[model samples]
Target: MKQYSFNFSFEVLEEFKKLLPVNRSKKILKKYLLNEYVLSESLNDLQEIISETVIQPYWMTEAEIIKLDRLIKQAKTKGYSINRSAIMRDVMNNLVDRYRNKPIQKSKQHRQTFKVPKGIKERLSLLIEDGELTYELSSFIMDGYVPSNDFPSMRNKDQEDLNFKTDIEVFDKMDEISSEYGFKKGGRAKIFRDALNQFEAWLESDPPKKAALKQELKYILTEYKNVENISIIKEEINKYLKE
Candidate 1:
C-alpha cells in the first residue's frame, strides 16, 4: 500500500461546497473548518502533537483541544517531523477497523456442467469416427466444454450431482479406481482419460444419450475432486467447435 499526502485549504472548502446543496453546504462547511483547525500549526512537531491529542482521541472536546495545543508547543521545543493528515488518517483507519468490523466477502463456489451444441456435437462425432479425437480428448469433452447453448443444462446437472465435492476427492477417486483395476498409468491424468473413453463410447453408440451420460460423468468427477481440469476441457471443446 502507498501513503498519500493531501493539502486541504479554504479554497478546497469552497470547492467542496459546490458538491453540496445550499441548505447542506453550511453544515458541511462548519464541520470541515473545525476538522481543519488541527492542521493550522506551522511546525511539524506541533502539528503531530495536536493531531494525536485532538484528532486521534475518538471524541474531541474544548479542554482536550487546549491540552493538545499545550502538548504541541512542548513538542516544538524538541525536534520531530509529523504531518497532521497522516496521523489523523492512521487513527481514523484504526478506529474504522476496530469499530466498523468490515469483513471481506469470498466468491461463491459453483458446480460444473455440460452443454454440447448441435454443430460441435456433429463435429465431435465425426472426429470420433475418423479417430482424430482420443479418449483423453473425449474425457476432457465429457468434463465440460464451451460453444454450446446446452452448457447451462450441463452445469445444472453437474451441480445437482457433485455439489459438495472438492478437487482432491476427484483426484483420489481416480487413483483408487485405477489402482484397483491395475491401470498402467494409475494417476489423475489416466483416470480422467478412462472416464473420457467411457463417455466417448457412450456418445458414439447413441448421440442423443451423450449429453445425459456427460452430465453423469461430470457429477462423478466432481465427487472425486474440484479439479480445474474443466478449463482445459473447455479450451479443447472450444477448439473442436471452432473447427
Candidate 2:
C-alpha cells in the first residue's frame, strides 16, 4: 500500500461547490467535505462507483465459513445497503487500520473521523484534568468525539489494483482457507501465497530438506484429516514426502 496526500481543506469544499448548481451556504459544503466516503471498487474493470459496486456471490458449509451473511444482515438491519464482500473488506481494513503502526510491513491502514461534536476540545481538556483521559476513554465518555480520519485505501480504488479480481468464488475460497488454517480475517490469501512460495522452494531442493515437525503439524497430519480435500486445488503438494 501507498500513502496518499488529499486536499481536505476549505479550498476543496469551495471548488466542489463551484461545479454544482443551486448551491447554498458554505455549511453545506463543509458537511459534504466531512462525510465518510464508502470504500468501494468495481468487480468488472469497466465501471466506477461509490459504496456501491458495479455488481458483485458465494458457498461453503455452515462449519467451514466465517458467517459473513450474519454481518451483512446486521448492516442491513441498521440501514446499510452495501454488499457482504465490501462489508468484509471494510471490517478487515478497519481492524487492521486501527493498529496500523504495529501492523506487518506493507499494510494499508488508517482511521477516519465520521462525526465529532462541538466544544469537544474543551470537553477533552476537562476530562484530562478530571483524571487522565485519552482518545479511547473520551470515545466512551462523550459520544461524538471521533478522533480519526478514514481512508478507502484498503480496498481497490481503480483498475491498477493487483489484488483486484471479479470472481466472487476467489473470495469465498479465501474465507474457507482462512477458517481451515485459523488465520485472521482477510489474511488467508496472503498466507496461502506464502505457503505456495515455500512449497515451490521445497520442490526445487536437493532431496527436499526435512524440517522438524512441530505439534501443529503433527495435529494437522493426524487429527485434521482434511489434507487430501485441501490438496484438490494444488494436487502436486500431496505428492511430497511426509517424513
Candidate 3:
C-alpha cells in the first residue's frame, strides 16, 4: 500500500486476541477510501480505522531507541540499509519463537529435564508448528523425556528436515500480522514492506527512486521466504532501523 504523510494516534491494548479477535468483523465501508483504505482518507478517518483495528500498548523505550540508533549507523558503515520498525518487527518475531519453543519453568515442579539425542527441538517443533501445543513448549520436552520409551518413536519417525520454505510455517501467519497493521491492501511484498516502512513517508517518483524500491521489494520477496530467512534478515535489518 502506498503511504501518505497523514498521522494519527490510538489508545492501544495488548495481546493479539484482544486487538484482533477470532470472530471479529470490520464494520467500515470499503468505499470510504480512495484506494478503499478508510485510513488514507484523513487523519481522523485513519484514527477511526485504528480505533477498531489496534488495541495494544505500542511504544519504544529510550534504551531500545539508542540500541537501534547504533545499529543503523553500524549497518551504514558496512553498506547496509533498513529501518527501525522492521528491526522491531523482527525482534518481536524472535521473542515469540524463542520464548514459545525454548523450555521454560513457571515453577520448580515445571522443570522437566530431558536426555535426548540431538534434533529433539526440531522434532518437537512439529507439534508447535501444527498448533498442537503453542502454550506448552516445555511440555514437548517433558513428554518426550518422561516417557523414555517414547523417545525412540519420537526420534525415529521418518521425517525430513523441516523445509524452511514450507515446513517453517510462520509465513501463513503474515496475513494476520498485515491486517492488524493496516497493510491489508496490495500484494504480500507490499504489505511486508509497508509495515516495515510504517514510520516513513516520502514521495518518490522518477526512475531511480522507483528502481531502488523495485530492487528492495524484490530482495524482500525472495530473501524473506521462510522463518529462517526472516530471522537472518531481522539480524541484518536491526542495524538499519536504528537512526
Per-candidate Cα lDDT values, in order, are 0.37, 0.31, 0.31
In model 2, the worst 10-residue window by lDDT is: 51-60
What digit string (tens of lDDT, one per residue) describes model 1 on residues 19-134?
A: 33322333332344345334334454334322111110122334434544454455556664444344333333333343334322222322333223234435455534333233
Question: Pairing residues by index, what is the TM-score of model 2?
Answer: 0.20
Question: How good is model 1 by TM-score?
Answer: 0.20
lDDT of 1 at 102: 38
lDDT of 3 at 195: 25
Candidate that beats the other on lDDT, 1 or 2, i.e. the better one: 1
lDDT of 3 by residue, 170-208 (tens): 233435444554654443333323321221121111122
Task: Indicate whether candidate 1 or candidate 2 has the larger TM-score.
Answer: 2
TM-score of each: 0.20, 0.20, 0.22
Better of 1 and 3 by lDDT: 1
What is the Cα-based lDDT of residue 208 in candidate 3? 24
Estimate candidate 1's alpha-carbon lDDT, on a 0 to 1 scale. Answer: 0.37
For model 1, what is the error of residue 210's alpha carbon versus the real structure, in angstroms, after optimal superposition? 8.9
